[model samples]
Target: MTLSDASSERTRVYVLQSRQPLTTDPAHAFPADRYDVVVVTDGTAQEVLREDVQAGPVTVVRAARDEWDSVVTSMPPDAVEIVTNDEYCVAACARLRDVVGLPRRHPTNVDGYLDKVVMKCHLAAAGVPVPQAVALDPVVVAARDTAERAVSTLGLPVVAKPRREANSRGVEMLEDAGAVQAWLARHDGEPGWELEAFVSGDLGHVNAIVRDGRVEPVQAGRYLGPLLGVGEGRALGGWTVPAGSEWAARAHALNRAVVDVLGTDGDFVVHTEFVARPDGRLVVLETAARAPGAGVSELALVHAGVQLEIANLRLQAGLPVPVPEPSGRQACWLWLPVPPGRRWDAARDGARAAELGVDVRVRQVGREGNDGASAAVGASVVLVNDAPGGLARTVDAVLNEPWFRAHAV
Candidate 1:
């Protein structure tokens, strides 16, 4: 059908964006011929929209995060779809669906995905293996007692995490009762904290597309190290598990169980992380109702033909999701956080990456320090190879290089 012929019958889709999409051309995700698309983003995102998209049929509207409710309520009620891939905006999008009189397209227990304490409770109730967690209210005078109680219950070396934050923003590891006490005292009177027993196992994640409660597993991979290690100057990276591998099957099954327990009544992309214990048991660490960060979605695009973020957008817009086919190439991605007061020297990093003699795609190069945000990406690298262990070995070689430090200004 011609673009003009389909315009009159197009479904109105409103995409809520908090950051620039990983897709080079987001407009292509929602074809102008089939969907009338409007992107609702903040003022900061205006400049990032590509020029062609700005001149196309898709419309752009500026609405700050805090002002989303007002902006959503004022939107024309005829809008058929509301979509967002941002972690911070998931709950808001769920609530806004009601204001527009649209049928609930998100999980009924949406809070379970937003709050760690609530999420663990739901998963535990469903007989899913999750870490034993104790919720903590901010305490002032009784901080020591509170810390001692948590340690006594959950054991020593607990992980203290903000219940609602994402990207490991306020996560801390307390090795002893005294450390927990000190950590608690520092954040006195702050709310929404929880303590869970630290699970020592291989960290891995699975990304999938869910439609009508059926999960189509996309890709599963093992992390080089814990995400928390990134703050200690460790380079975070992971390699995709080859199709039909034992780890892939186990990860996919665990991901399926998580979706079933989490109430998968709607269509969306689910990002799940789990710890594979040495004894062959998989314990879900946490799950999100949106696309994952750290170039994972892009890695999926490389390993499989499906880009999860784009699939997420298409699902929300009532468009058909593309089936993923293995590309016969294993993919690995790395993120190097620029240290404080240092800038990313893309030229030098590119030069170093070329020495590895593999396909190294530099996805992003941050020119300024990332300010210690665990979620920030100072530089990103993607490597794909057809050999069985080529990607993993190249990832190791990339990590061993002093690229970030050697190019220090």
Candidate 2:
């Protein structure tokens, strides 16, 4: 084919990345022969690499987050596809599509996906069960009656969180009115805050792929505890719910309902988290229009044949995604945070993991003395097993025996 023919045939994809892409091999994800990929980054994340740019079919462009609009506008007005797994870039990608005169490919309810308050409202409107919430803007937050009204409406022990942040950032549980007032005092001028009635239950998530507006359920998993408890002397871990199990079925049903109400008119991956209340009620917590963080994607790869990040990228590039099938195996991912004043002991941890089995994969190791909030994760663990209950047993051993070892700096 001539250059003109090849260029015309190849799909032009603009991947807005905030962090490292999930796939280790970018070439494989966006093949040179099929895609003309331009990776736009804010330089805040270490996503695009020298080798990726040097290789064929990929071009890297650096633009500060604030300048993304201008950068995209200055580009050639040729038709292009927008793709991003970054939660912060979801709306930006959607808006940029209009700027480039490309048809929208994201969920029509983009605001619902980005803002927690909006999301709950949308779900509740569709008769989907969600936590009772009160949106607090700057004006409402400043009023003296705001805290009292919120506490009265949602009752005590309310969960206050930023309306748009992910990874449980700025989430706090206020057990009393005084605590709520104090929390509000700290954010007197900020916007995008919401207070919701605390739901005490087991936290779980369902991941699915949406193709041509069809919601394809992938894997449902339950977290060991709330993600907010990550830095509070709690390890973050989760295991895939066994396929065909009651828990998986309930999760899948809820996931479908969520996607349906959230306007599933496009191809993408949806990560929806819900709470399984002790009363046997499943209430939707939140949903994101992107791949989940941590090793959840890795777990999906083992549980089924789909890795969510790659699937999301493919969906955006107009490429075909794999139809996920349960592999009749189970997988789990664990994140161990290094205690304050301690550093990770990779040798001891590796040895202990080996003793457990060869299925264990140590995905990440933190730097020495990196005990800050952002760098608190000392190690990441992902493992898979075929034997019945083998995955849970291994996870128990890892937690009880504590495979993640650390040394004082």
Candidate 3:
């Protein structure tokens, strides 16, 4: 095999660690013998130099969290690929990749993927369906009259959110004109507030791998309940829509459209959320270039046969991406939010959640002594079960059981 051959030649890979670790092991796709792996972490040395990084002949570099660009710029020119599963790190990774002349999404276009305001604008311009939206200028949003004028076009029950945050952070649905005014008053000084019409429909999502304009179905799921109506500190859980169905195809197509509009130079992982109207129309909510967080990647591996971490790395390495077919197995996942000021026995609770079914897989739970924990604060459970309906029922039962809420007070 010549050095020009992609499959035969060894590749040097650089992986940047997000606040959370990779969903699947890096070695799954790139065997140690075929790849030289270097892991860079923003975390403390003690935190990142753990079992996984030590398990292989891998080098760990500890850098200040904000110095990712500098770290990448200084890498040996021979380093062939750079990738990160972190959504927030996409821009810096793109910048570094561009600097090294690596094939990936252009750094100039990442804002359209990360920022909701810019994202909707691009989608709309591309003739993709998106909820009506307006970015509230800071000065106008602070004034009652101007704020009302800014939001008038979006109509009542508008959704307000920060332009750049994810996992629905700073996302809220305002019911009426008064609610809109109150939301503006609460977020008075904060800039980058975007208001959109609250589309009424079932919230659905599609995760897939797109290479050269082809999309492979990862998993299509629908939210079991109203996401924003639950208010703060609420965990959103849902079941995967049965694969190989009409609805699933629409979701996949919508995801593909998002990728086409965003325009990536090579294969990329897409996590797109959309709303499915009762009239059978699918409207895109937003899309991200990185793998979906909160164990959705695990769900895809279990039910859809796609290893996202591997696919992402493979694409970055310029290797041919193998699309995985859906297994037709029903699956469900949940991000259980742990309330603040309470200690949790992660092991015991995880076991109880597991006992819900034989196919249950509980990825993680918050351990004791961790207070003020919420989903955003890194306290949550990532559970997937074979029984689609059973997963939600079991989770609800466990959450409601008085004994289940044992506080380490």
Instruction: Return the number of clashes found in candidate 2.
Output: 0
Model 1 alpha-carbon miss at residue 22, Å: 5.9
Give the C-alpha miss distance for residue 326 in model 3, angstroms. Answer: 1.6
Arranged by lDDT, best first: 2, 1, 3
Stretches off by above 4 angstroms in model 1 are 1-12, 18-25, 32-38, 41-43, 46-70, 73-75, 137-142, 341-345, 355-376, 402-405
Residue 236, model 3: lDDT of 65
**TM-score on alpha carbons, each prediction:** 0.85, 0.88, 0.80
Tell me the tens digit of each residue's lDDT in model 2 across 1-409. 1123235466566788765453434555667776666778876434554211224444777888788877667656554567787787888888887778765678887988889988998899999999999988653365669988998899989998889888787789999999988888888878788999998899999999987878998999999787866565578988898879999999999999999988789888999999999999999999998888877887898898898887887776566778999988888888777667767556776677778774333333344565465436666677787888887787877787655656676
- lDDT, candidate 3, at 407: 51
Per-residue CA lDDT of model 1 for 148-240, tens digit only, reads: 788889997999888887778788998988888888778777778888999889999998988877888899999988887665567788879
Top of the candidates by TM-score: 2
Q: List the residue pairs that clash in candidate 3.
A: none
Better of 2 and 3 by lDDT: 2
- lDDT by residue (250-279, candidate 3, tens digit) is 888888788778865456788888898888
Misplaced by over 4 Å in model 3 are 1-12, 17-21, 34-36, 41-60, 64-70, 105-108, 138-140, 185-190, 226-233, 341-365, 373-408
